[model samples]
Target: MSAQFIEKYRENAEIYTGSDICKQKSKELLLEINMPNGLLPMDDIEEVGYNRSTGFVWLTQKKPIQHRFTKIGKQVSYDTHVTAFVENRKMKKLHGVKAKEILIWITLNEICIDDPSSGKITFGTPTGISRIYPISAFEVEEDEKK
Candidate 1:
């Protein structure tokens, strides 16, 4: 219903990242960061190089690129250098802030994998596996402006 609520109920809601209110609030700050040369990076780092695909922008490298069928047999291209610049100054404002701490940051954690039939398997999910982004991650680089 509101920003705080949206940030709570829908941490990953499109409305949170792409809302009219969010646009107005984060525009100025968001526009200062560098967008990747072609597309946004798909890896975890301090600032998440995430871009909006359809709904709510997920700020994790864990996101997947979309693909479609073509003469080449379901081919897709992701340059990571062509990430779109947030031209709408209004939308640029919603860039930086500490995403609410979800599951406190632990140095390490165990990841469990369970097959529909099997019992379970445990693997170590390493640190830096995920990152919460700063607002500056979306800005355009100064050297990039030619």
Candidate 2:
């Protein structure tokens, strides 16, 4: 049957025929969201730390930019935030930057970072896992700063 009675039962029709596996729900979808803090190997993270209990590398979330940019009036515009974890303080010291500088560095490098010297953004993240949210979403946490 061609499912002419589907509307009566509120069923829908979507046709995609390529692989039979595509029609099946992912087994991974049922798995728990237990993403742990660990450095993505390709991230080229420096200053590795040791934890006797667990072998997990400490990692931080980084937003990746996946759009284009342009000049608006006299200011530059961007569409994404690139973020990630720095392995340790030594990485910062080696880069000659303090804690505050690191955060600013992320924003600065949101587009393309090309500083050849120490102040350049040295580390990289897994690329696609960076958090990309609207600035208004930060409102709830902003109140805590004051």
Candidate 3:
């Protein structure tokens, strides 16, 4: 399959591979979308919040570029408004519970893929998992804004 097709059907193929590959690919794709010049500055991302319950670090773009991921003969759409707001509010509520740092999660309510060649369709439902994380999780460098 072509790189385009691979990228288009990556989520489905993820089950066959480890999450490391998916993380690397996701980073590459997101970098391409936000950093066309190949310069991905750390400041381009902002620290939203953290989820102590899940121990995930959440980060959001300092600027809203194109959030959609696309490929020839394929389409991907995501809605972050509801999840983003809910997570942010929940983060605020956690301030008094435990000072444990947390990262907000962006949940994709729905993911639909249309394959023209095979004339097939695939849909993924959100398991309430996050798509991105703050660099802090790796202890590389803490999110500047956080």
The numbered model that scores best in lDDT is: 1
- Rank all candidate structures by their TM-score, best first, as comma-separated numbers: 3, 1, 2
Using Cα atoms with residue i matched to residue i, what is each candidate's TM-score against the true structure?
Answer: 0.17, 0.14, 0.23
**For model 2, which pairs clash?**
62-83, 62-84, 62-130, 63-82, 63-83, 63-130
Better of 2 and 3 by lDDT: 3
Query: Model 1, range 4-65, lDDT digits (tens) per residue?
Result: 42243233334323333333323322434322221222222212223343222323222334
Write the residue-wise lDDT of candidate 3 on 1-146 in tens digits. Answer: 12242233234222212334433433443333221211112223432222333322223333433221222222222211111111211221111011111333232332222322443322222444332322222122224323
| Alpha-carbon local distance difference test for all models | 0.28, 0.20, 0.25
For residues 1-146, what per-residue lDDT tens digits would candidate 2 score against the true structure?
A: 01222223222322222222221211111111111111111122222222212211221112222221111111211221112122221111111111112223332222112332323223322242222222221112223223
Q: Which pairs of residues clash in candidate 3, taking residues 3 or more apart in a chain or in different chains?
A: 50-102, 50-103, 51-102, 51-103
Better of 1 and 2 by lDDT: 1
Candidate 2 lDDT trough over 10 residues, lowest sum? 25-34
lDDT of 3: 0.25
Report the candidate with higher TM-score, 2 versus 3.
3
